[model samples]
Target: MEKSPDAFRTISEAAEELDVPQHVLRFWETRFSQIKPMKRAGGRRYYRPADVELLKGIRSLLYREGYTIRGVQKILKEDGASYVAGVGRGEIEPRKREGEMASAPPPGMSKPAPRVKGAKGEAAPAAEAPAQPLLPLGEVRVVVNRLSENHADMLRAALRDLGDARRILDPSQGR
Candidate 1:
């Protein structure tokens, strides 16, 4: 028989609904301190509705959004489990972590000033930060994948440039 919407689910049921293995669910319990499943005799676990939602959020963050376990932990700490649950429920969208913008302006380009209401109720421009672009989940994955691939090349080029500069500065040291 199908269960009620508010019914507690077993570890296997929860794992199946989340499309993850039961062991993965068990592992998540260890990593996320916020996941507190009710334990009965024989140490059987029963996941409440809220717990399932939190797991879905964590799954989305790790697998779909490509966030590290530590990153997800920071989100749980800063934003709370309820916020994560909201993300799982599709009521809230996940945002990029600080310093991890997907659509940052190119270097040498300044961000636009923010618009504000003046004392006379006129729209005035104020110094506000640029808004972040809301990219689709698929596009975000592509961008992140490209960045990881290019990051090493960028670092290698930087190191080569630094070495060449050092050689030019100290000819004797090059020997």
Candidate 2:
């Protein structure tokens, strides 16, 4: 029988659910003070629902979103555990909306900048957070498909700008 997702998960269970290796989870525990899984008599780990969620968020930021370990650490430190948890829970969609991005990219692919500022000097958030971050073009395609009738021309321009920005940032890029 399958256990409920809400049930506490073991180290293997949490690692499998997060799609990361067990050692990766162990490494993350060392780096992230927030992930405190319960330990039994033999020091076996049993991850709580909340702990798993936090791992999800951290993995997204590090593996998918191209954030450095230190960067994720700063986000957690500045925003607090709840904010990171929100990110993991898909509540803080800060880039292209869910279902718009791809699941993963080839090894050489690079992620685009997720946040930018507005014309008025206000910090503009990215389109929405990436729900399935994979490659840059996937998100551009999303912007294209979602262009409202009234905003078609403007969205086209925006897409063009995105393309240029992506070209400039590609890690393998050569002028």
Best by TM-score: 1
- List per-prediction Cα lDDT, in the order shown: 0.79, 0.75
C-alpha TM-scores of all predictions: 0.61, 0.55
Best by lDDT: 1
Global CA lDDT of candidate 1, please?
A: 0.79
lDDT by residue (tens digit), candidate 1, 56-91: 999888877767799899999999999899888888
List pairs with backbone clashes in candidate 2: 93-129, 94-128, 94-129, 95-128, 95-129, 96-128
Model 2 Cα lDDT, one tens digit per residue, 1-175: 8789789999998988999999999999999999999999999999999998899898887766766688788888888777777888889853322322333342347465344556777766667534655554534554434334645665567677877777789856543
Output the worst ten-in-a-row residue range by lDDT, candidate 1: 137-146
19 Cα displacement, candidate 2 (Å): 0.6
Clashing pairs in 1: none
